[model samples]
Target: MFVNFRRIRKCQCVQLITTCLVLSLMMVCWEQLDNSVVSHVKSYSYRYLVNRYTFINKSFTIPREEAQSFSNFLYLLDHPNKCKGQDVLLLLFVKTSPENTERRKAIRSTWGNETYIRNTLGVTVKVVFVLGAPMTKPEQLLWNKRAGLGLQGELLREDLLNGDLIQQDFVDSFHNLTLKLIMQFHWAHIRCPHADFIMTADDDIFVHMPNLVHYLQDMARKGVMDFWIGHVHRGAPPIRSKDSKYYVPFEMYQWSSYPDYTAGAGYVVSRDVADKIYQATLTLNASIYIDDVFMGICANAMGVSPQEHVYFSGEGKAPYHLCIYDQMMTSHGHIEDIYHLWKVATHPQVKQRTSGLAGRLYCTAVKLALLCQPYHFNTYPCKAAFL
Candidate 1:
């Protein structure tokens, strides 16, 4: 009996030691996690609270010649009262790379050929190529060498180089680019002075302009104009790695749930929302995420809700096969796929596919439409009766 009791006692002692060890290890881990959180928070707090507008005005200035030209253009374009209730403007911001020439050509061609639809739908779309510095005039000329394609629109050079935009010290540069684009839109409204809705998209995106118009028209009918619309994901963790360009230290955005932030590849904000964003910029300091997420968080702070829609894809995948049906917008595609996707989206026969044939056609048609389209920017008046 004594022997059994001694054995039981020894087992209890072992269990107690194991429990103590586990508790100690857990405490250490908790401390480490706490330290990490605190360190991250500290790193961002200073940067987050700094006023971006002050920095822009104080640290950065547009050159006199450029500033005067920009001001003159703005003076010519600004007409806030000109924005009518029915007009919609689409803005496509493209980051041109050498490998993307064919893709760019395809997009330009699609835009060129779709004039009839735009006129009918009462939509005006402009593509602005925001070229990186490494992309020279020679390279741009080479890409433009091809004829018979429809790559047209304004080419706006970014003030900062590729490296300059991404440098850690140039947080202000990021905000400046975004502000410049917004200012451009503001000027566009003044110039045309009648657009009701503005769509901002990336070069990689393929927009189903007609469908987008219909959707917005329906939304307008319902009297909804102050909201931001795009694809939204729940519980996206803030990027924290030092190596990543999208790193966000914890203090600036501590929450794991980004309330209804849109995937920036394609999104439409009403004119009121656009004005609100511009106004918000006056007070909000810029956070270092890609332009899309930054817009989301900024809109959130300004009381603009991002309504989630499935049409926008942040991941580089298409919603459907390119051959089967018309794609409204596909975010990331290889050079060939981008070209084929644009061709398929704009093809009349491709649009007529009613069922499973759409899927099968994508695979076969992809190889058939590999030719590059030429680029030119001209106002194509829509032949549609509404216009």
Candidate 2:
């Protein structure tokens, strides 16, 4: 009787264990099924919404372009050896007004100055400013006065260190900005196509040349080409309100959202795509107010896409943290902040730092807190959001 009772208890224990194992397997299967259903719903909903949005805003127009000629715009006065030598690493172009001589001076003294870059970083850099022809004698006088040259300044300043300016024959006005942009690409396409990389920035920007050089080297080593990189804006809608400075009329561009484009303030491109974009400019609409968006349209027509980088601040300055500033490549709208920014960025104490994991973490948290700060911060007016 005792043996039979023991056998019955063993059988009951085995049945209980088997039941628990089956129950656990069933729960796992149920959870997976639930998750799969949820994922499917989300995927379908996203696709549907995106399709609907695009369908609603679909727009197109045939540009009434005549036999466009960029050759008529060549009013170059001083053509420097844009690249130091045959093996030029970067051809940096700064877009400036004919009268923005102070900004140009500040740039040459700071980031745009290539002497320090070549001497210290061992990278060949060429700095050139792109401008359009001045309308009147006073405008010409202003340019020559600020640039410190005579009436034959263009001819005489050929050998001058700071004479690396390219002034095309187009009327120098805000409306002619697109012509100015295309002219740069055309100059690059014909004059300096063999350059490894090219960059375009505004006169008011503060560029950390050392950081930019390192970034370019990495891209070159990785064999990156057809490259267009900066602070990319995706699906940015046109400013329809007439009161705004960026207002775009429907007659100009019917599309609601402009194609993805890097900010015009500063961007980098490889040799492979420079010519392609120059060709694109010949056919794409050239009447857009914003030069960056116009370039974006040209790029889109050629099926080339813009790559986004956090370091390139578009239309804004980056928040001033030591680590953040050290890593940033470009910041915008620094009209008067250029000198101050250069001082802080190149400070010796900020350069030599020994930080462990904890230090990095602490700085990152602090930056995050600052990044999400409410309105009325430096990030505003400067557009200093972390890219």
In order, candidate lDDTs are 0.49, 0.72
Candidate 1, residues 1-387, lDDT tens digits: the string is: 437888899999999999999999999999768766765564345335432323322322334454343223212111233234534454444444323455566666664233655666666554444332222244356655431123221211121211101111111233234444444444444543345566665556666656666777777778777767766644344666666666667666554434346765667777778777655544444434356665655576567777765445554444344332343433444345655655566566655563365544553454233211122111111110011
Runs in model 2 lying further than 4 Å from the true structure: 1-67, 78-81, 137-161, 374-387
Off by over 4 Å in 1: 1-103, 112-122, 131-193, 251-259, 287-289, 319-327, 355-387
The ten-residue window of minimal lDDT in model 1 covers 376-385
What is the C-alpha lDDT profile of model 2 across 148-232, one tens digit per residue? Answer: 3342354335326466888777766777778888878878877787888889998888898878999899999999967999888
How do the predictions measure up, each by TM-score?
Answer: 0.54, 0.75
Cα-based lDDT at residue 15, candidate 1 = 100
C-alpha RMSD of candidate 2: 16.5
